[model samples]
Target: MAKSTLTPELAARFASIALGHVRREYPNKPDHTLAGPQDAQTPSQLHPVFYGSYDWHSCVHSYWMLARLLRLFPDLPVAADIRALFDEQFVAEKIAVECAYLAAPTARGFKRPYGWGWLLKLAEELALHDDRRWSERLRPLAEIFAQRFRDFLPLATYPVRVGTHFNTAFGLRMAMDYAVVTDDRDLAALLGETGRRWYGADADCPAWGEPSGDDFQSSALIEAECMRRLLPAEEFLPWFDRFLPRIAQREPATLFRPATVTDRSDGKIAHLDGLNLSRAWCWRSIASALPECDARRAIAEETADRHLAAGMPRIAGDYMGEHWLASFAVLALEA
Candidate 1:
């Protein structure tokens, strides 16, 4: 099969999937902490802008995907709808309330690294658009997460090496994209330093614990992708060598294979679909860093194609996977 690329047709399809749910507030799974009866509020009441797509983080990244689609395919028929939605949702008052929610004492670790990283990524994408309205309105909320990273990374001496939302490497990788775009040199330096500190010495990753029941990421591949983004080419190449030295031979055979998803309707089991897509993202990115003649380059390219083939077909189906799979599909195809 041919590699799955993000054409305008695919962008529109993804946009339609996101637009269908980003505002559908029902069937919500909130990552909320209710302090009392007074704190009992609907998802829309608490998170006006991000109250759909099953949960807050899913909503946030779905917005990110929509913003990205708008930027990449501005002439798509859905572009006007996306712009109108952003105008309606990213107003100053609503954003201020969202910022206040993040500042609440009870929400100190509400979404932690995962949601925090994605929020910054949304901020990054919004800034790319010609209109400055959305990015400016969202800046305060983004800054709160940026500051959260500044305060949290120092205390986080160890990395969460899981293929799930809490994975520290995935958080760092996404946040680094924002830091670079915003030219926050201090934040950039801090993220790079924290990445090296946590993963610099990680050699010969056995990848023994991948495809865990609820994992949506590949811990081993994401770590390499993280290093590729955080460190310079000369530095990351050697690190990649020590990290997954047998890529050419595919010794850690699991990394080359796409994960199987038996049931897309089961939320956690559905994560395997995301795992496949995200692996494609990582493989494509990691391959770009390799020289043309390198033996691993071809292997990485082929594996990415296999993963994309497996994952793209399942981007939309049951609500469990449909709520968020398109975002990972965007990452894989765009990468």
Candidate 2:
């Protein structure tokens, strides 16, 4: 397959805005170190979403963005700094475990895991670059993930399906990546079955009833990628060709709509607006999977250009929304 070319103008713009946001928001540190006043602010302080604060899922997503930037513009000094920030702030063993397995935060705020699959997916990318130490460190988390899949198998018997989006998606991604690394057929089979049962025959649409916007699109992309690796090209190609365009067209509005104000009983309008970049990350997955497809190619190019121009701060609050920035950067750079 031919590589996609990265436009110099776009690269500079994305790197500059991303770096500038990091510098301004995290002043006094080259990497994303949080302390003092920055840490004291509410979760909404960082983004429009109330669940952004203390959500490890969001933190991992931002790390994905940084990792992509590092891969795309490795020669840039800012890339090195962003890499350091990811190492220091995002990529930790305990952090991964907490976000992937724990359940305490759902009671405190939103019930979503914000896009944790991207973290494991990013870990796989880092491992491919010969960073075996981190990859090895990430293996146990995959094991924990495997066990979770075992527990969630009986869709009808499972206690609740509505809130398991992050869990199910992360579990499938980690299990498939784990199978690749360890050559475990059991894990692969488990992942394949889960994908088939929940994501349709080709894993094109929602499998377990109706899923939210992020869950539906992101899970489809992850399932499709995993199945592509395991199934014959002929078996998966038709579905990939059919679904990529639909996802490309539907994702924008599902993700970037302005927050609507809701009337509270106390006669106050609650302002609700923020960009959730997970859709962008899903687009990145689609782009990565079918780089040759025309519609997906155009969507990936246009979305990356828009993000580079937006200059939104890429942090935990913006993690779910902006995690795609890195995946897009890697796609563009490698293209």
Candidate 3:
């Protein structure tokens, strides 16, 4: 099936697009939970290093997107610029400031699992660089999130199966990547256990109701993706068959098609664009885990392309969407 490609040019375009926002503190759209007097300060004052790209979570992931692109295409035209930005932002003092914000009583559960996961994912990408310096500097924050996962997963009685920021599957999947790269045995084991506990028995998921106006992730697909990571193919295949049964028939219908965004200006509605891109990665990931001869493989790839087509073009026009959409677009195309 045909698909959108993440070529060198596109990587450069995406990197450039993302660089514009990761540090653009103004016109911010922070999701802060201010409680005391000090909490009323601006986002940058609180999150010193990550107060841009509309909100903390978006800024975290956008940094991940840039780190990933540079690693993939080290010779990108904007390579020097990328390195410069990292040098400027990944300082020990800056990271400490970002860490301090988490200490605020009002910021206790600041970004929770969503932003928590992205920060770890960013650290994982930095690990791939030949230099271990950035990864080490990033570890303090990554460790915090890693510990958060270890502490929270078991207490999270029901998995958040939403297609929004708080989605547990998305958090687990990304955090799992960090654990694997850093060899965090405790974090890795906890993730696996919690994932299975929450999703091991799930099956026949009805995914017809999806792409809610503010959805940027697919609850059904992401849950399946998490299961894929934790289980061997032998176990995962049967589980997947039961979870998304009748894929060959496209029974859920919504799972096979791209969602339409009625308005890009509305930041909430623009999440549909992110939904398409994120769904594409989830489809690609799901397809990779399926048996080679499985009919779902072809459908997965085809629909991934359809979703990519639906979101890739609109990733940068509106600042509302532009703030974070490119990160998801990169994931879909790279997947």
Q: Which window of 10 residues has the lowest lDDT sum in candidate 1? A: 1-10
Best by TM-score, which number? 1
lDDT of each: 0.93, 0.43, 0.86
Against the true structure, candidate 3 has what lDDT? 0.86
What's the C-alpha lDDT at position 255 in model 2?
Answer: 31
Pairs of residues at least 3 apart in sequence or in different chains that clash in candidate 1: none
For candidate 3, lDDT tens digit of each residue in 110-132? 77779998999999999999977
Per-residue lDDT over 118-228 for candidate 1, one digit per residue giving the tens place of the 0 to 100 score: 999999999998999999999999999999999999999899998988999988999999999999999999999999999999899899988788989999999999999
Q: Could you tell me the TM-score of candidate 3?
A: 0.97
Error of 3 at 151 (Å): 1.2
User: Candidate 3: where is the Cα deviation over 4 Å?
Assistant: none
What are the per-residue Cα lDDT tens digits for candidate 2 across 1-335? 23234554555555554444432332111112243553454332432211221343434444444555556567665666765654554345454534443333222222222343444555655566544555565555545544445554554232123323344543465446646656667767866666556544342343333234223233444455545555555655676665443555645343323223232121112101112233334344445555475565666545534433332233213423232343344432443
**lDDT over C-alpha atoms for residue 301 of model 2:** 46
Over 4 Å off, model 2: 1-54, 90-116, 137-142, 154-175, 181-184, 200-230, 238-335
Error of 2 at 226 (Å): 6.4
lDDT for model 1 comes to 0.93
RMSD of each: 0.8, 9.3, 1.2
Q: Is candidate 1 or candidate 3 better by lDDT?
A: 1
Spell out the clash pairs found in candidate 2: 4-335, 5-335, 198-207, 259-272, 259-273, 276-321, 277-320, 277-321, 278-320
